[model samples]
Each structure stands twice: as C-alpha cells, then as structure tokens.
Target: MRLSIRSWVKRVTITGSILAISLVSIGCFYEQAARSRAIKDFPAPGKLVDIGGRQIHLNCQGRGTPLVVLEAGADTSGSALWQPVQEQVARFTRVCSYDRAGIMWSDPAKGQRNSHAIAEDLHKVLRAANEQPPYILAGASMGGPYVMTFTKYYRKEVAGMVLVDASHPDQTARLAQATGEPASNPIPMAFRALAAVAWTGLPRLVLPDAEVPELPSQTAKAITAYQPTSLAAAFAEAAVFEDSLREAGTFRTLGHLPLAVLSRGKPWSAFSEAERAAGGLTREQFNRAEAAWANMQAEEAGWSSNSTHQVLADSSHVMQLERPDAVIAAIRDVVVRATRANATP
Candidate 1:
C-alpha cells in the first residue's frame, strides 16, 4: 500500500519523538550509574538518625559537655568537609556532623527545602538522635544560614552558633542577579541545574589530577558504590530547597544568641594576573567576597549581637578541610564562652 504525504510526515514526527525520548532515558541511566559509583566510593557516617520520615547519616565521636553539630555545604559535601577538624575536635567534646536530606545517605523525607524547614529538620534530628539540647550549631557556607535559621526559631534549645562562610542575604541576592533571577528566589534552580550537570559529567570526562585531594581508599570505594542515590538526592534538593531558603522573611525571626562568624580571607584580586587570565577568581569566590557579604549580614543577625567574628586569613572556603586548627580553635572558643556563661554568678 502506498502512503500519503500526510502519513509520511506523521511517521517522521513519531520517529523523532521516540529517538528524543530514548536519548533522555539513556542519559538518566548513565547519571544513575555514575551516582551509584560515587556513593560507593565515599566513607560511611558513624551513625544514623531518623528524622521527619528520613534517616540522616551522621558521625559522632568523643564525649563532653556542649555538643557540637556541624552542617555541611550545599553540594555533595557531607561530614567529610570536616575531615581536617573532625579528629582534633573529637578530642575535646562530642562532635557530630551529618549529611542533610537528599545528600549522602540522608533520606529527603517529610519537609520542604526552605531555610526554616531545614533548620527545623536539624532540630528534629538532634532530638530524635537523643543529642542533648543547649547545643552549639556550626555550619559552613550554605550551612551557615541553615543553622542560623535553626537558632532563630529554636533559640531556647541552642547554646551557641558558629557561622563559617555562611550565605548572606545580600550576597545571595547578588548571585541571583548575576545568574539572572529575581532576588526573591533563594536557590537559583537554573544555576543549580548547570552545576549538577558539571559535577555529575565533567569529573568523569576530564579525569581529575591524581594529586587532587582524594577520599581515603576505603572511603573512596564506598562513595563510588553509593553514587546513584546520593547524587540524585543532592541534585533534587539543590534544585528545590537551596534557593527556597532565600524567600523573604524565611529567616526574619532570628533571636539574640551567642554566635561566632568565621570569614575566609582569600582575596579575589590576589590570584596572579596570569591565573585570572585563565578564568574566574581562584582563591575564594564563594568564601571571599560573596561569603564575606553573607557572613556580615549574618553577623548583623541577633545571634551575632555580641558575637566574635574571626577572619580566617590563611584558609579557603573549606576551612574545616583546609585549616582544622583554626576551626577547632573557633569551636573551642565558643565552647569556653558557653561554659563561662553557664557558670556566671
């Protein structure tokens, strides 16, 4: 039977649609595989806490008063970001760090991605895990705001706070503007999509330098195995909740609480002009100018009303990873203050 021109056109359209769908499906399949590989490569947390319907992966070591809870940044970072400082602090008091919902082994369950929601989830995690209250909350980069918002609403439960390169409202606004979004949108979904693609695909294609900081051998193997679920959840959370925290008034209720701000001091213009010629600021984009702006605003928050601000000049954004001594000192300082406050006449 001979086919009419109209029928041929329909046949071609259907074929194209099928091909497009197949490609997308294949891409997703590869993404899942890569994620599985990444997760299988990393280290597992010390324990798990069930909160808001999800099980959060966490590691806690040492024992002492004034419990310290460390929050990781937005990307795929977990407690691993504190590798530099973890052991050292573990010597002093009980130090706990965990992967947030949709990252690592933390199941993204039962909450929105807003700052307030994330903060509340942390609270629930602490309570469910039986972590004693009057605790000190410390978060770096995106985590800064997470803990700050937590303290804002759960002031009575908190003992103190440590904001390290936390996200500042003004800085977030600038980034949103730079990426062409209304300042109102906190987590820039468009930018996050691009970042997700880069983190997921580029590393495999480019093959990182062997000298690049690598996870420990066993840890690396575990992370690689757990890749699929971890990456998928992380990407999903970044797309939804990261910017969700930026919605106006999400953190309007900050209360007066003891706080410390650790600002990274890597200068943007310090990169050799030659390096600048290569690309964007190398020393510290997120932790330098942008982080400074955010930390400053956080300093203005009621929590920082009588706080100590420390500029970590020798460190990068990952102060915990790069300068554990400084991070430890900062945490210790806060612990001392809290101790003194409790003993006041």
Candidate 2:
C-alpha cells in the first residue's frame, strides 16, 4: 500500500509540472504571434516623429488656420480614438491626433506617467512635427487634464479648448461619496491581470467587440491584437491617477480661453444592478447622484471666462464616437470664436 501511494504521488507531481510548462510555452507563443500580427496588419498610418530619442505617432489631416489638436482619453491610442471626429474637423481646419508615449505605435519612456509628463510629450511632438501652435485643443476623459496642463504651461500657443465628458480631479472622492464605496481604483489591478495572460492571447478571445465598436474594422483588430501593450500602458497611467488628479488641480482656470464643456446626458451606467440593489439605492437616490455629477461637469465650464456648457442630450461618455457631429460643431464654434478674436487685434 505504501509503495503504491508513493508511485501515485510522483505521477501527480510530474503531471502538474508538465501542465505548468505547457501553459507557459503557449503564452509565450501567443504573445509573439500577436505582436507579429499587429505589426504586419496595422502599421502606423501616420508619421512617426522622434521626440527626445523616442518615437511618437502623429496623424494629421485637413489644412487651415488655428490647427485642432485632439488628445484622447487615458490608455487610448489617440490617432485611432480621434478617427471619426478628426475626419470631420479636417474639413474646416487642420487637425492632428497623436499617440502618447508607450501607447500604440509610440515608443515607451521611463518616468512617472502623470498628466505633466503627457502634456510635455505632446508639446514636443507638436513642435517636432511642425504642427505650430494657436491650436484648438480638444480632450476627452483623462485627456482633459492633459490639455488643461498644456494650456496652463503653453497658454500663448492655445486659442481655444473643448472638454468631451472630461474627467475631474474630484471624481474619485465624489464617486466614493455617491456610491458609499471606498475610494480605490480597480482598473490597474484588472490591467495587471490582463497583462499577465495577454501573452496567452486571452484578451483577444475575451474582450467584447462593443468595447471599440466605433473603430474601423482593421483598426479595431489591430487594437485587439495589441492588448498587452495597451493594458501595460493603461496600468502605468492608472497607477498614478491620484497624482495626475492633483497635478490637474493646479490648472484652476482657463482665463478667457474659448472653452466648450460637453457633458454626457445619459445616466451613469458604470454601476451594476446588483451593486445598486445591495446599496439599497432607490431610483431617487440614483437620480440625485447623477444630478451631482452633472453639477460637477457644469462647474468645469465655469473655470473658463469665455466657456459654454452643453449637455449632449443624445450622447454617452464617448461623445466623440457616439455624437461626432456635436463634437465637430463644438470645435467649429470654438474655432470661429478664436478666429474672430484673432482678427480683432
């Protein structure tokens, strides 16, 4: 009986070892395959300019005065995220969108991935690409802080600004109070887990098509294939969310800059039904929370002396994708105002 038990234990141990080895090998293979496929299938559609010994991808379309610069949300590939809106804005004036460092086709850089760092990189990219200033800077979500930082530091170069359902520095704390949950970010943890298995191509298998439903078919595929890099970049940014928020707070006002704050009209749907029920939150409670959120958005518009706050009645958080016309109109309004102002003196 003792001899038989010993043999069974040895067999089980060997099986486990082989299984672990096989999984690791498979992960490595998928990682390489995904990387290769991404390169071949989705080569950078824009010019890759070298900035500070690292390359950043910049895609420019259209031609006119008062150039429009699109800054995408955190972890998003700016060039891709601005696709639908970029094309429309190009019809009126020159518009450019770029990938931040370590995202999409941009080369990775080492440092604290805060809004200041991102804004600095953007300034360099614009200068290197010869996309001169007096730019109409438009940002969405986390991009809001970045453009705000840029506007603060390079005020003279900016003519106007647009915030598309932009993030606020007080968001985390407000959300916690609204939801009665602790203030913490689960996104970085989620990204870390995804990165761990990204080598296995699990992201491609599990990620929903709806995640980037607005992207072109090929671009969407490229994004899916490049999940590992995306997740890593996202993780880096999310890890310093609080720090970025604090930095963004310093840029308190827009001071007569033509600013358009496009707030989402839809209800916040980030919370799960189970969570709502568990919290004993009634419809009235939810509505109140949403009202507070909208109030906060309105407060952002108040930061600028010459700003207009518009709630996009038919749009979600990603107003650029869901309601490109609204975004375009906002940009056009800012441009027209800026042009008239420039003509004044």
Candidate with the greatest TM-score versus the true structure: 2
Off by over 4 Å in 2: 1-4, 75-77, 188-190, 267-282
- Whole-model lDDT values for every prediction: 0.66, 0.83
Q: Give TM-scores for every candidate, taking all chains together and pairing residue i with residue i.
A: 0.73, 0.90
Instruction: Report RMSD (Å) for each prediction in the order shown.
Output: 5.5, 2.8
> Candidate 1: RMSD over Cα atoms?
5.5
Candidate 1 vs. true structure, TM-score: 0.73
Residues 310-344, model 1: lDDT tens digits: 77667667777667777788888888888787778
The collision pairs in model 2 are none
lDDT of 2 by residue, 1-345 (tens): 999999999999999999988987887787788788788888988899999789998999999989999999976455687889999899999999988887888887898888889889999999999998799999999889888888888999999999999988788788668766576554746557876676677666676542577878887776665656766666778888888888888886888889999998975475568866765577666666677678889989999899999997778778898998899999999999999989996
Q: Number of clashing residue pairs in every model?
A: 27, 0
